[model samples]
Target: MQDLTQAAALTGPAGGEPRLVAIPRLAAGGRWRVEAMRAISEPMLLWFTKGQGRITIAGVTRGYTAHNAVFIPAGVMHGFEVGPQVFGNALFFGKDCTLPLPQAPHLLRIREVHAQQEVNVIFDMILREMNSDSPAHERATRHYMGLLGVWLERQVAKAAPEQTRPDAAKRLVARYTALIERDFRTGAGVGEFAAALGVTPTHLSRCCRQACGRSAITILQDRRIFEARRLLAETRMPVGEIGASLGFTSAAYFTRAFQHLTGKSPTEFRRSV
Candidate 1:
């Protein structure tokens, strides 16, 4: 989860049109840590043209090389460490330009031969748009972004699972995630979440372990912590107010939880950022 706020500052304010940043060929022996994991807080369309690299997202690691393209949804923790340093371009757009996906926030890894070709072309188009100084550059960039969105939708459609196992445990965990995303501010406990999902607390814990690799309570806490971080980085609200907003009964408890997950207190994080 890269801190998008800082990235935005480094890149300067958003231009009237899609701004293109060309990362030229890496120096023969130089290494670059483009940005910390926390710097990438927004959804980004990324294309890798020439390099081998490893990306870690949400505790899942994947290796990538030349001609590989990936769509990283917003708010999902992700960062890349490149090997054989590569060159690519990233097109950052606001929510208005982003297209909806059938299954959201899942990384769409492009693998099909034809689909890879299409992705390559999109990368090339981005390079062309960056190089061209024509008056129509913005229009060209927007068109290519639209094309990229459509391509992503197609790739997700092709790659997404037809159906996940319908075990009751899995369903229960899925329902819990949905509810947390929708109603975390309600201060609901694990037992309340299980009851709403029509499962016993013990069953919910087991289901979460099998499906999400964590207990229901852990997932809920993570979501709250994530939201707390988002506000700390994005808003000027006071720490106590933020705690109350997230349903924390006391600011001290919220501070402890935030420190446990982020290794920094809310005020510390906000000040450092």
Candidate 2:
């Protein structure tokens, strides 16, 4: 029963009368008020109906205005500040909603009148289904969300060559990410990863920079740091043991690295969470 209208997550794909898409009512004037640099594991789409504000993803900030549908990939740091006159629909899909989901954050404005109207209609239908008492509510919600994904993909396609990636770039990053997820605990560097992918380190880093908005080393650091936070919050592991297990040369090394990137020592991070 948490209010995903602002900031949230879901276990997986929605079941019924799913809370996947609903209009977020802002506090007081109209601000989302989630500014901390935290990672979300679920993919999300944000559609703004009016007003403008700043949306920062991966340390980049952009203006969000009416009819802007922002596609946020899973496992990235993002925050939002909506202006007072703004109201919008936010759709939270589990990480596995559909194939070709964006692997990075992108903001696209729905410029066509018909496309804008269609998006508005879909959001309204989703809200209605979520409130209904029908047995097939969840099924209906899934259908609508699938449609949302299709429209979003088209919008992203228009922006891919400029801000995002082409299919080839996506494939390369996908392979790199898969290898990192499987072997990050072993303390592999960009060179080792590039070797495994059969590409030079420079080539791999170029792909990551173009496709992920960050360098290859930064991506590895993020994956490691995200896991460190998860383990610190979810388990009772000792700090030193966590460092050694994550392939850090020493406990002090791990602490320094975590602090440098997250601005918090491991213990401080654990306490905050």
List clash counts for every candidate, in order: 8, 2
- Show where candidate 1 strays beyond 4 Å: 1-93, 98-109, 127-133, 160-168
Pairs of colliding residues, candidate 2:
16-138, 17-138
> On residues 167-221, what C-alpha lDDT tens digit does candidate 1 reach at each position?
6665565556655555666667887777777779998888777764567677778
List per-prediction Cα lDDT, in the order shown.
0.62, 0.69
Candidate 1 similarity to native, TM-score = 0.64
Predicted model with the maximum lDDT: 2
Query: Candidate 1, after superposition: displacement of residue 241 in Å?
Result: 0.6
lDDT at 192, model 2: 84
- Model 2 residue 239 CA deviation (Å) reads 3.0
Per-residue lDDT tens digits for candidate 2, residues 22-73, read 3345233112124333345577788988888876565455688898898877
